[model samples]
Target: MKKNISLAILAIVLLVLPLLFQSRYTQHILNMILIYVMLGISVNLIFGYIGALTLGQAAFFGIGAYTAAIISTKLGLSFLPCVLCSAVMGCLAGFIIGIPTLRLKGPYFAIATIGLNNIICIIFLNWEHLTGGAVGISGIPYASILGLQFDTERKVYFLLLVSVFLIFLLYRNMISSHYGKVMIAVRDNELAASAMGIDTAKVKVIVLAISTTIAAIAGAYYAHITNYVAPDAFPVMESITFLIIIVLGGAGFKYGPIYGAVVVVILNEYLQYFEQFNMLIYGVLIMILLLFLPSGIAGIVEIAKAKYYEKKKIYYLKEVGIDEMK
Candidate 1:
C-alpha cells in the first residue's frame, strides 16, 4: 500500500513538473535527463546485471536514431512505425554483434565493443546516400500518436515521462521475476551457472539484445525530439559517457539510472562553462565520486536503508526484553 501511494505521488509530481518550470530550456534539460536515464538503464542491464562491460551501446543507439530518421524522413512513416523499426534494427544489431562479442571475457569483450562503436560510427559517416553521412538527417516531423501531436517541449516531456515510466515498470518487473534471479546467478558466477544447467551464453546474448533495444528506443526518442540525427552524436565517447552514468548512479540498483542521469546531466550543463577544462574537471569529479562512494549514490541509499532496518530490529528486540535476556 505504501509503495502504491508513493508511486501515485511520484506520478503526480512528474505530471505537474513541467508546469512548475516556465523556462523551455529547463524543460528541455529535464527531457534530456530522462533520455539519459533510459540510456543508463540499458547499460545497467548488460553491465550491472550480466557483468558485461559494453562500450558499443552507442552503436545501437545510433542505429535506432538513423533508422527512425531514414524511415520518417524518406519513407514518410509516422512516429510509432519509425520507433518500431528503430527497435527492430537495434535488436538485430545487438544479436549480430552479441553472438561473437559476448564469447570473449572481460577486457577483451569491452575492447570489441569499442571497435563495434567505431565501426558503426564509420558507417554512419560514410553512408551518405542512405544516412546523409556527415551532414545528418533533419526535418524529422514532430511525434504524433493517434492524431495527438507532441510538438512542444511540454508535450514532449509528457510523452517521454510516460515512456520512461513504462520502461521502468517493465524493468522492475523483469528484475523481480525468476529470470532476474538467473541473471544475478550468471553475474555472480558464469561457470557455476553453466554447470547448473543454465545457458549462460544465451542469457548474456538475450540481455545484450534487451539492453540494445532500450538504447535504440531512447535514440528514436532523441531523433524525434530534436528533429535531427547526426553521426557525430553517437561517437565512442558517448558510449563511455553512458557507462559513466551507470557507474556513477549505482549499477544493479533500481533507481540508479534516475540518480545518475540527474547528476550527470546537471554536472554536464555546468561543465559547459569550463570549455577547455570541461573534460579535465569532469574526470576529476568522477574520480572523487568513485573514491568516496565506490558503489555510487544508490549504494548510499541502500546502506542507509540497511542501517535503518538494523536499528529498528535492535529497538524492537530491546522492547521485548530480548536484549536484557541476552
Candidate 2:
C-alpha cells in the first residue's frame, strides 16, 4: 500500500512538473533529467543486471543521434521512423562490438569498450560527410504524432514523458521475466550460470544490444528535441555519468536508476553556481556518499526500513512481557 501511494504521488508530480516549473530553463533541465533517466536505465540493464562495465554507451548514443540526424535531414524521414532506424543502428553496433569483446572479462572488457568509444569518436570526427564532422549537424525536425508537432519545450516534455513511461514499462516487464533472471544469474556467477545451461555469452550480447537500443532511443529523442547532434555531446564523460547514476542509485535494484537520475540531475543543477569548483564539489560529494553509504541512496532506504521493523518487533515484545507480568 505504501509503495503504491508513493508511485501515485510520483506520477502526479511528473504529470504536473511542467506546469509548476514554467521557466524554459527549468523545463530544459527537467527534459534532460528525463533523458538521463533513460540512459541510466539502459546502463543498469548491462552494468547492474549483467555485470558489464561498459564505457562505449556514448558510442551507441552518438550512433543513434547521428542516425536520426542524417535520416531526418537527408532522407526526410519523420520522427517515429527516424527513432526506429536509430535504435536499429545502435543495436547493430552493440552486436558487432559485443561479439568478440564480450568474451573479455573484468578490466579487460572495460578497457576494450573505452577503446571502442575512442575509435567511434575518431570516426565521427573524420567522417565529415556522414556525421558533419566537428561542425556538427543541425536543424533536425521536431517530433510529431498525428499532425501534432512538439516544437516547444513544454510539448517536448510530454513527448519525452510518454517515451520514458513506455520504456519504463518495457524495462519493468523485461526484468520481471525469466530472461531477467538469467541476466541476474550471469551477473552473479557467469561460470555457474553457464554450467546451468543459461548460455551466458548469448545473454550478455542480447542484454548489451537491448541496452544500446534503449540508449539510442533516448539519443533519437534528443536529436529531435535539441535540433542538433554533436560528437562532443556523447563523450566518455557522459558515459561515466551514466555509470555514476546507477552506482549512486544502488545498482541491481529496480528503481535505482530513477533515484540516481533525480539525485544526479539535481546536484548538477545546484552545482552550476560553483562554476570552476563544480567538478571538485561533485567529486567530494561522491566520495563522501560512497565512503559513508556505499550501498547508495536506495540502500539507505532499505536500512531504514529494516531498522523500523526491528524497533517495531522490540516494542511488540515489550508489550507482551508487560501483559505476561500483569
Candidate 3:
C-alpha cells in the first residue's frame, strides 16, 4: 500500500506536469513522449514479460493506423469502433505470424520478425488503392468520445492522459499477477519453466497477442489524433525505438515506458540543433548507457536504493545500541 501511494503521487505529478508548459512545441514533445511510452509498454508485454525479441512490432502499429484510417474515412465508422477493429486485426496478425515464427528462439526469432516487418512495409508501400501507396492516406479525423470531438491539442492531451493511465494500470496488474510470475520463470529459464508444466509456447503467443493488441490500440489513437496515416510513419526504426525503450527502461516496471519515452523524446527535441548528426549522437548515447548501465536508468535507481537501505540498516542497528550484540 505504501508503494501504491508513492506511485499514485507520481502519476498525479506526471499527468499534471504539462500544465506548467503551455507552449505548443513543448506540448508536442510531451505528446511524442506519451506515444513512445505507449509503444514501450506494448513492447514490454512481449519483450519483457514473454522474453520475446521482436523486430516486427511496427508492423502491427502500422496495420492499426492504416486499419483505423481506412475504416473511419472510407467506411465512415466511429472512433471507438475503429480502434476495436484495429486491435482485433493486430491480434489476428500476431496469432498468424506467431504460429510459425515465434517457434524460433534468440537471434533467429529476432531475424524472423525483422523480415516480417520489411514484408509488411513493402505491402503498405505498394498497395495503392487502399493505402494510397507511397502517396499515403490523409484527412483522418481526430478522436471523439460520444459526440464530443477532440480536435484541439488540449483535448488530445486529455485523451492521451486518460488512455495512458488506464493502460498503465492494466499492464501493471497483469505484470503483478500469477501469470506474470510464470512469465518471469520462463524468462529466467524456459526449459525449467517447461519442466515445471508451463506451456511456454502458448504463453509466448498469448503475450504476443496481448502486446500486439495494445500496440494496435496505440496506433489507432495516434492515427485519429494526428489525423493522417502513411507507411513511412511506421518504419523499422520505429520498432527499434520500442526495443530501445525496453532496454533503456527496465523490464517489469510499470513506469518504465513513461521514463524512457520522456527522456528520449526530450533528448531528440534538444538535439534538433545537430540535424542529421542527432541520429549519430543518439546511437552513441544508447551504446554508452548499455556499457555503463546494462539495466538502464531504473537499474541504476535500484542499485542506489539498495545501498541507501544498507546504510539505513547500519544506522538503525547503531541507534538501538545493538552494535555489540553481533
Counted clashes in each candidate structure: 0, 0, 0
Q: Which candidate has the highest TM-score of all?
A: 1
Q: What order do you get sorting by TM-score, best first?
A: 1, 3, 2
Taking the tens digit of each residue's C-alpha lDDT, what string does model 3 give over 143-258?
88999998877678878888887888888888899988998888889999999999999988888888998899889988998888888988788898888887888766666777
What are the TM-scores, per candidate, against the unseen true structure? 0.97, 0.93, 0.95
Positional deviation of 180 in candidate 3, in angstroms? 0.3
Per-residue lDDT of model 1, residues 155-199, tens digit only: 999999989988888898988899999999999999999999999
With candidate 2 superimposed using the best TM-score fit, by how many Å does residue 197's alpha carbon deviate from the native? 1.3
Give me the runs in candidate 3 sitting further than 4 Å from their true place: 1-8, 324-326
Cα-based lDDT at residue 41, candidate 3: 91
Better of 1 and 3 by lDDT: 1
By lDDT, who's the top model here? 1
Tens digits of lDDT, candidate 2, 1-326: 99999999988988899999879999998898899889989999999999999988888888888899999999999999999999999999889999899999998998998899888988988899998999889999999888899999999998999999999999999999999899999999999999999889999999999999999988999999999988899888788888888889988878888899989998999999999999999889878877886777788888898899877777887877743321
The 10 consecutive residues of candidate 2 with the worst lDDT sum are 317-326
Ranking by lDDT: 1, 2, 3
